[model samples]
Target: MSVFAARVCGFAEGGKRRHQLRREGRLMLNRFLSARSAAVAVAVGLAFAVTAEAKTVDPKTSSIVRGDAAALGFDPAKLDVARAALKADVASGKIAGAYLLVGRHGKVAFQEGFGVQGPGQAAPVSDETIFRIFSMTKPVVSVVAMTLVEEGKLDVDAPVSKYLPEYANLSVWQADGSSVPAAKPMLVRHLMSHTSGLIYGFITPTAPIAKAWAAGGENRNDLTAREYAKVIAKLPLKNEPGTAWNYSRSTDVLGAVVEVAGKKPLDVLVKERVTGPLGMTDTAFFQPEAKRARFAEPAKGDAGVYYDYAKPTPFLSAGGGLSSTTEDYLRFVLMLAGDGEYKGVRILKKETLARMRQDETTPEIRKAGLFFPGPGMGFGLGFSLVNDDTLQRPGNGTFSWWGIAGTEFWVDPKNDVFMVFMVQARELAMEYQRKNRTWIYDALVK
Candidate 1:
């Protein structure tokens, strides 16, 4: 039995206090009914019933369950220790709340929630709580583009201007406040791998191009995808396309390309090609009115501001505009872990997924140390590929990424396991993500 299962079983077996409490309550009820008042007896009985329900624990459920932790080759004790540490972190006020799910060999061994959703919010985080996944949306968008690639509707190596004419000619920004024409056109693959020389305006407010981006108001919810693209194209790029690895707004440009190729709005195309097929009903650019109660509030100390998921935005940021529940995202990761199919719903062919997972960072970029997330990882088509086991705790070949609001997920194919951690605060996101990596790997006995 898994440690969680065994713990539940042991509690049931040793619950003498529970039985004694029930017996005593029953006797008191009978005495009250016989001697004094029937109303008092009913009230006492209801109290006892509530107490009993409070002590019960529900069984864990997963879409796929091959075996328990021990049967799947894991140390239950080590896993418990990791869980305890996460709970401790919450109690210590390092974060507001967190939810974790672990699946191995197709079976879910650990799925739990801890702490309240946010300060002044009485409800605790649960499996169904929705999070602002932020940059994590890039992987899904990248996958959608790849589907077009599979259908011969799009080409990754083609210059982005082939479909989006606004990008046909662009200027490169120089440190001396001058601009030069780009030596080469930006390609689709460059956008996917974040080598398109685009930079987020919020990252460096003082840069001339960044200032221009902010001034243009490209990210306002009132702008359409094509309109956003037009504004971005007018700005000077930080580097020549495909020459340097810069964390950027390239994915947003890719979204505009997807819209042009698919002939549909990015939101509709994603629903048709990805989320709808995968049954990720809770994932979307805007949270529906009905789901407002389940949306987690961002913790007080987040470094950056976030868009209101409850309202529609003018531009669907393929880069960071997505909100999803833990359960829904788990389904998405399961599909990735299962090589692009979830319960026979094929989002991408196995070969395509393999290509997506391969590190696309050129040796030149790696040698220059321009790769985001630093030395131990390299950029893939849409995800970060683990290049060194020492830096990234997961096994090599793990594909992973996180959001600014403390949400993270990783697919470790070598270990046949995938894990996700969700929290709504950004102040300590990186710290918690790193801690989760260490704790999760420490529990892997096999």
Candidate 2:
């Protein structure tokens, strides 16, 4: 089941709460909704029509509920309970600032901004805040890559060496410290599926690639894609291409490939294929001085620790190197919901969009459990695909990817639902997964 299907199942199990928003008496639905709310609701209905029957949240209801979230989806009794628990954590200094946006179809029914910006600041978070989207940028990069595919400039199944021949002689890691030569070259699909033997340079505590990645060994933000590929060319892959699934810098390499294939810089390719078409004006690698203040300060745990956006040596990591607004990111996700088109611009073909969303991993690959565990869940091109609702949290048919700095986004074709949580809390983000993410989705299931 997809996240939307899980949401529907959650709703069915949620029982009476699903009908709580039904208008009564003179409460006109229009009075409760905002234009944005209605548009999203309509989009959700249109996008996920066949996954599982989903009902759009009325526009008026969305607006009214967003203004006063206590009435949104909370079981009235649980409302106080959940709020108290959350407040208690904040009071104990367990968190700083957190923002959440939830919408069904195309409309946002719940928007909540909570906590302080830091230890001494009381200014609450707003919707316009920016976040370090980290690996979440992977999917966006994947989208950009697919756009090239739609234009017939790239092939997901083709060997990476076809475009960057240096990758043709890559070798795999041996169990001991030695290396073994690859039987085949890494393919574009392998990179997207994480089966390209590339290492995230962060995963696998004992892996040599992990150590090298930590030392910025093969991963360097200072190097251009071409330069970065040269560095990776000298390193040994952790596994044979397509033989295992390991989160790696393969997407970043893909970013470089896009540049070579399109004869443009990575950022330029991203803009031409994604941001420009989606009207994501604020999404980019370099943040102008004027917009610097809006970029949220990343936190260590509960303490909001500020860091420079421009790493002393900048490497436009296509895998994790973009800053965006909640609204701008929403537009990008909306395009995914619409299956490639947003408003009038067609970003990808519906068929291509479907292919991107389905499981790209074989049953054998999935059974190897190289990624997150799920009953029917498997890796898609760049996002995680839902295989069974029973193994999922709330949203079914839902695909998700998050940034390292407490930012997350998901698209549930089943519910026409798309959600994003933007914050500066990194180490603290995972600590409150249930209250911060799981419960938030649980609250937005309708």
Candidate 3:
């Protein structure tokens, strides 16, 4: 039986409880029909109200129906089905444990956890499970940079060398693998859009600099942000800063730059300006001793046991290293959904949020798959732009980013939906997983 099934069996005791179970259970079973049926789309006002309800409603309420789910054009019964499907999938080894939270407008319509924290634990998953949200950290870093932009501390168009003069002399890689002088310097915007010529050491095997990056042995585990920046400064840049699009360690570098500009540690600045104001207490570069027990170990496959990184590293990778819980991340998404406000806690101006969402890439680079795929989608400041079908669902104006360790989150302002799925496994079957996830959304909103 599925986890939901097992849990429900415990709840279906005597008298009125049994009757309630039968009614809700039967309704849930019929959700597949309601999902694909020709019911009219939910009204915009109701959808908004439903999402808002999710933000405020207590989780201890009845499981048969959720107020916000119903308002967002989802049948409560169908939502139950989706929940069951998610549990069934995870239990059967389609994936390891996963925590899902979906909301519309500013409210969360559904929050559920499935499978075990590890193999032998009987305690079911909860909202507090900590996840290593690798690349998702990029968005948070980008938001920090934008916050700096709002404060007039940085400019998107200006050359980064203006702030760090070391970049003033960067050169490009020639066809023969030798360095050549660049006509133009790398700019802050180049780093943001990934049009800057810098390269991520992991992507290319034949490039000499790639080899250097591998052998540099910078001891990322022991270096602080300042130390990492100093190590990177001595390396050769892959290309001229702005001539082409290349995914690089640009965001982490940007984090170092943020440190330089803010005159504080990256973690400290993020805590003060972002997570603190947004109430994401669980998000941090270093896990507190008490919370370390809950950190989900990264795994290579569904059945493979999870493991921590082999090295004892100290550097907190701004591009990829924040650990957070589904609830904490959902709160971040909710703030974005609310136009930068959550329960009157505003971390950014509405206008600044608008800028972050705007497409920042050119047409040529977008077609080259320099960023995410979707119609009308492109890379914005930090998150993947939803401009094409691959990144978008039925809704337009959606954006998200994922971690290497199977954590994904997206915000759809057009549909007023924010969804997060956190897991510990690596190399997920993304297409199949996305199909299943979309099926649930379609069924719920139908």
Candidate 4:
């Protein structure tokens, strides 16, 4: 959920400087790093200024430093092979464009951009190309919700009906299509954990509730968050609250909970609480017309989900609607890696973050559905918790998530490592995430 390094020294510095970090006051130690490394690390919680060595953006503050792959304990030539493989995908037009970033010991090793901005477009992808991060937005919203939880403004145990009463009498849909009242109240934690029985239409396209959603126009962009929650509440749920772990609209409902609890719109709450303080300048529900040209495109110009990014919409899909750049999103995850503080700004407390990373589901609940985290992972408050090395993933204590349109990220506090992969090809997301993990983990030779 979040990590902190205090009074540290010589991290991932080859064998030349193997000094141990003093776990003093945790986050306060960030102030003790050497001026240059401290700047790079803070830029990583990263102020995320991508440079030409790795394509940097104009920084609002200190810039993130890219490390030598060999010095960081990665085989430079092997790493090159991995990069070449992805670059080949771009060249073959398998994906529109891509950006990959890997950071370890609070310092990034590389950030690479590939191919054209998208499809047949003339622009090449750069450090600032914005992407539709889709479900990746959930983790951010979950962070924002946790911020409110830290402030004592939101209660994780409280019934969703407490914030949005529309959820109070929600109905559960049976296989035979009959509905019954929920056996338990859907709590705030349920929404964050996607155990609220509110499944996504696309994920449950064959379900009766999914059909109801389609006919009821639940996907309308014109309704506000509260109105959208009302529409969702009226529909029958896929299961009883907390009984199963289904990929859901729960985060979208949590957005309404956040809006009602925080007394503001989802976008405003995110800005004022999370993104603004962390300097995630390019992360938002939509981009301004000025920044529209920087938006990434699909192989087919109009095939991507975001066709109205420049237009106004009353409801921002807190679960699946956000556009961001690698640098901006990197800053946010770096903040998580920094234990909820970035550039000296504290969002959620370290203990709160720890709670979010702890496992929240049983094997029975996970076995109930597709269980997107795969073999070794479990669902946490808002992330996939890596509990074992059973899968070709990171070690235990890694918490991560990804966007539907090929954007994936993971922060491994145990290894002081994290990665961000950005691309606009929806079909390649799962495929690339699986491949990139091997490419990255194999290179972690030290």
lDDT of each: 0.77, 0.64, 0.63, 0.75
For every model shown, the clashing-pair count is 1, 25, 13, 9
lDDT per residue, candidate 3, 179-229, as tens digits? 777778777777776777666665555567777765654324467666675
lDDT of 1 at 443: 78
Question: How many Å off is the CA of 349 in candidate 3?
Answer: 1.1
Residues 120-155 of candidate 1 have per-residue lDDT tens digits of: 788889978887888788898998999888766789
RMSD of each candidate relative to the true structure = 17.4, 13.5, 16.8, 11.1
State the local distance difference test value for candidate 3: 0.63
Candidate 3 lands at a TM-score of 0.77
Q: Residue 27 in model 1: shift from native, Å?
A: 76
- Kindly give the stretch of ten consecutive residues in candidate 4 with the minimal lDDT sum: 1-10
C-alpha lDDT of candidate 2 relative to the true structure: 0.64
TM-score, cand. 4:
0.85
TM-score of 1: 0.82
Model 2, 1-446: lDDT tens digits are 11111110001111112223233211333443544466655544444342222222111211211333433444434334445665565667666666676666566656666675555665666666665566677888888788677656788899998889898888776767667889988999888888888765444646665675555455344567778877777678877788776666777788878787777888887876677656677777767778655666532442212334443234667677777777678877777777776665566777877887777777777555366534576788888787676644545667877765667787877656667777665565565444555555555524
TM-scores, all candidates, are: 0.82, 0.77, 0.77, 0.85
Q: Model 1 Cα displacement at 393 (Å)?
A: 2.4
Question: Could you tell me the C-alpha RMSD of candidate 2 in Å?
Answer: 13.5
Candidate 1 lDDT score at position 1: 17
> How do the residues 1-446 of candidate 4 rate in per-residue lDDT, one tens digit apiece?
00000000001111001111123223433664644466546545432222211221234763366787777767777678778997898878787788888878777887788887766687878768888777788889898888777666889999999999877898888878778888889999988988888877766568677888767666666788789889888888877888789888788889999999888889998886667766678888878999877888877533325445566677777887777888888887887898876665666678888889988888988887668777778888889888886543587889999876678889987777898888877667688888888888888888
Which residue pairs come into collision in candidate 4? 3-339, 7-29, 43-46, 43-47, 50-55, 50-56, 50-57, 51-55, 51-56
